[model samples]
Target: MAIEYLGLSQINGPLVVLEGVQNAAFDEIVEMTVNGNEHRLGRVIEIYNNKAIIQVYEGTEGMALRNTHTRLTGHPMEIGVSESMLGRTFNGIGIPIDGLGDIDADKMLDVNGKPLNPVTREYPRNYIRTGLSAIDGLTTLIRGQKLPIFSGNGLPHDQLAAQIVQQASLGDDTDEKFAIVFAAMGVKYDVADFFRRTFEESGVSDHVAMFINLANDPVVERLITPKVALTLAEYLAFERGMHILVILTDMTSFAEAMREVSSSKGEIPSRKGFPGYLYSELATIYERAGIVKGSKGSVTQIPILTMPNDDITHPIPDLTGYITEGQIVLDRLLQGQSVYPPINVLPSLSRLMKDGIGKGFTREDHQDVANQLFSCYAKVGDARALASVIGEDELSPIDKKYLEFGQAFEHQFVGQDLQENRTILETLNIGWKLLGMLPRKELDRIDTKILDQYYQPADRD
Candidate 1:
């Protein structure tokens, strides 16, 4: 016989305390009825001495302590899993919202997926081309790696994400391409609509799925959005052997939502009023990306988070940096100069790209070109600083060249048109062309043989 309890204990925001509950387990799904017939879903978060506190996913908007009836369902939260989920749009909690009927679920999967075995993971290799020079040439995104984009407020992080979705996958066939699983949490309604409109209008591959939780939706659903999205990615990648690319945007929203739930639980807050377990909670999501030792398919991740007040030391991006492989930072200065992606190449890098992009992968001189670009760009700042003290006309000939190279690097290399899709070879060629504007001796970063081959002096004299 199932146990049903009459609730009159307490209610706090999204949480409700039900007294005298027997045989209740943590994370056990609960069914709550309001005004006799209308039902809502909840799950037990904390259990103490037969008393359970449940988080209502639909929010406790209509229910009261006295009128609500609660029943504990034995199992934890689960979502139906199947390959049919592709090319569909879903609400935060795995329910289809694209007007496409119910999924033909092959099986049900627990939203909190199993922990990945460290020994089973394969170090990521091979590059995933984004068709953008700033990334494809400088901070190459390697397959099966977890690379994050650290953006600030008002930056085009959302537009950048859509561009990535339109270009991230490779190969022309269904089996050869990568499947995209995108999760948007605590985003504005217009932002969600922009994603949908872009994906459909761009004819983004049928191997794409999105889970969205809007600003007005219940905060509890924001927490569940990423978990359910990853559950589906894991199913497709590890089990069904399909290459998966997971994009999680505005992770700051997720962290904030956690703070709200934690505060409601009366838990002690850590740094910046976030829970102490924030790091562990974030790891559970990021570490889910990678390839197992024997699996042909890999799960690569690009998690985007906007820093509060553009502070890099903020707990959200700071903790994320410790867990992720590397980050792509968007610079406000570059944005002011009218760069589309606004990627500050000096600080942004991919840790595993060195192993992925050389010889057989991208090009023979890929590493050399990237190194020279970084070295020259770094010197541009020094030349500009000296110019500020003594006028630009007073600087040495070499310093003047540095200023010119910087201008070309930003306007020509980093910035590209929205419809422009440059191949790896094309990006490398542009790098060499920019390097040519400087004197041959200034190109000390490149090897003597490489300079002899690719460096052609311009009519700067």
Candidate 2:
């Protein structure tokens, strides 16, 4: 259907109220002309009985209410998708940013595409090896899962993201098709530069499609960045039959942008001045990842967000925890100690870990090793805390052994260089070596047959 011209009246802080529009859908694309220049788009957000609230994409700056003309397109915001999108870079709005020529539009997909039906969704059962031992061994990333990485100010979440893009690959040899779509929201120029340099150095830029929204850009642009990136990911994963990994950084920024727009629109505030619909808003993005039954492709997500004041209970991380499968939590304390990954194994978890590890998926001993390690380390942490309160002389010999095991686990097994990508076998071997520091009697979790194959004496030649 052709778009109809709805006269615009009164610009309210980047918002243009449109008259003569009835039943306008949210996220529908509208074009506005200013000073004889026809800007491509605006998005419909709220509608009330023949009147629609539209956010002008190029902003209302230099736009006169009487002079600007508004046309409501029947379609929503969309991105041109094709195999050629790989190896390209786009701005927050899906326009080319890599200095590449305009994209040939073979197909256009709505940014807010429909999600998979509940009954038709397949359980994520395969592993995505990111080569980071802390993740692969402890909080395993299952293919088609929506796992988030929780970090805080001054943490190395960017390095972790780069490592994942550099090393993430499908476990099956038959799946040669894999791609990455990265979206950065409200990031600083230096941070954006670092990502580009890292990708170039790693030589994975060819497989990556990036959409960056800098901090200086209009706050409303950040709101559209992730949706545009995911639109492309869905196209690659479902339409092209390729395994797609979507990496979105600083989701808190995205949420903040939402709050800013909501405030401007006079919506009632929820907790901490955020909109009341924060949970549903985040669900719209996180729920987009999954494997559909009978489709050869899947969309896996790793969304990175910084917890406010290192508080996980903050609305952004809190709401995210409710929607995502699990989180990979970065430890600021460990980072201060110069640990590269700085993953606090205790609080971090992968709810889908059970489906992705052991036997045919990874290795036979994978599950047992992970369980034994977690149990022992947890006990060791308890012993160490007790020792801190009461002197070491008050602890039993077995407790002291556990404390040593916990120390070895963090220093040797959990921590590694940001550039190193250990295979599942290498990660398990490191776990076994740390376990060997304790007496064989403490090895109660693993089967005897598996223990005989992998366990070695700590003092062995």
Candidate 3:
């Protein structure tokens, strides 16, 4: 039997305090009726001796302290999940918004999922080709890896994310189902429409599921978007056996929302006014991406966050770097130089790339090509810096060649057409073509055997 109580002790922003509560559990769902006509739903966020503070999904504006009746639902927040979610769009809290009607759910899953056990995880030994040379050639994304894109405001991160969703694949030949689940929190209406339009125009929306929270929606709902997305992803990858790629854009928005909610709750502030538990909160989300032992599917995450003022030391990106496998940093300098992807390969790397690319996974020369490209690109910076001090005409013949190589590198390798989708082999061959511009002795990163086979000294002529 459930007991319904009358009146709220206090209503603070999106939070409501109910005193004299009995048997109220943390994260338990609650139902509220306003004036006995309008109904609303909420969840228990804080529970103490006999009082519970609930966060209402629907904001509390018209409900008076003495006119609302609250009852605990004895369960945490959950959403009805199904394979039908693919190709659909939803609000922050899992409600459909595409006019396609609600999903025919096969089961309901808790939005706050359990932590995956470390013992049951399988090592990632294959790659997901994103087609962009800066990523596919150097920082190759591996299956079940959590690689984040550290971008800045107004730097075209959204465009890069959309291209990856349109072009990502498991390789040339694979008999497996792959899908993308995209979650956007605190985004404007126009930005949300851009993602939908881009996916539809590219004809890849059939395998994409979008969950969006507009800037005008309730602040509390922004907190639920990623959880609802991951919950559905778990169902699809674990139960239905599909390779799931989850792309979460602008996690900075999510962190700011947490700070706002924590302020409303009167909690102590940590770095940048974010709550102290921000690391644990982020870990719960990033840690969810991996391959389980007994399952035939895997979950890979490409969480994109803009660094505040391009500062990697900021709390959001700082903590993220500690948790994720590696980061793909988008450079403002490269973007200004008209590079499409703008990935600064010197700072960007995939730690798991070595295991995923080799004779069996990608190619025999993949590692050597990646290593030499990185070395040559780093030297490009040195040549430019030296030329700025003492003019390019005063440079040695080798330094002049490096200047030419740098120009070609940023233009052809880092930049690609918006619709261009290059294969892994194509990306690697492009690396060889660029490396051919330099002398044979300059390529110190390549093995002598690999050099004898793939390196052509006369190709530069």
Give the Cα lDDT of each candidate. 0.90, 0.87, 0.91
Off by over 4 Å in 1: 171-175
Q: Which model scores highest in lDDT? A: 3
- Model 2 / residue 256 / CA error / Å: 0.7
lDDT per residue (tens digit) for residues 407-455 in model 3: 9888888888999999988888888888888999999999999999898
- Native-to-model Cα distance after best TM-score fit, residue 81 in candidate 2, in Å: 0.6
- lDDT of each residue in 337-380, candidate 1, tens digit only: 99888999998988988988988788889999999999999999
Pairs clashing in candidate 1?
A: none
Q: Comparing candidate 1 with candidate 3, which one achieves the higher lDDT? A: 3
For model 1, the local distance difference test gives 0.90
lDDT of 1 at 381: 98
Predicted structure with the largest TM-score when compared to the true one: 3
- Give Cα distance to truth, residue 305, candidate 1, Å: 0.5
Worst 10 residues of 3 by lDDT: 452-461
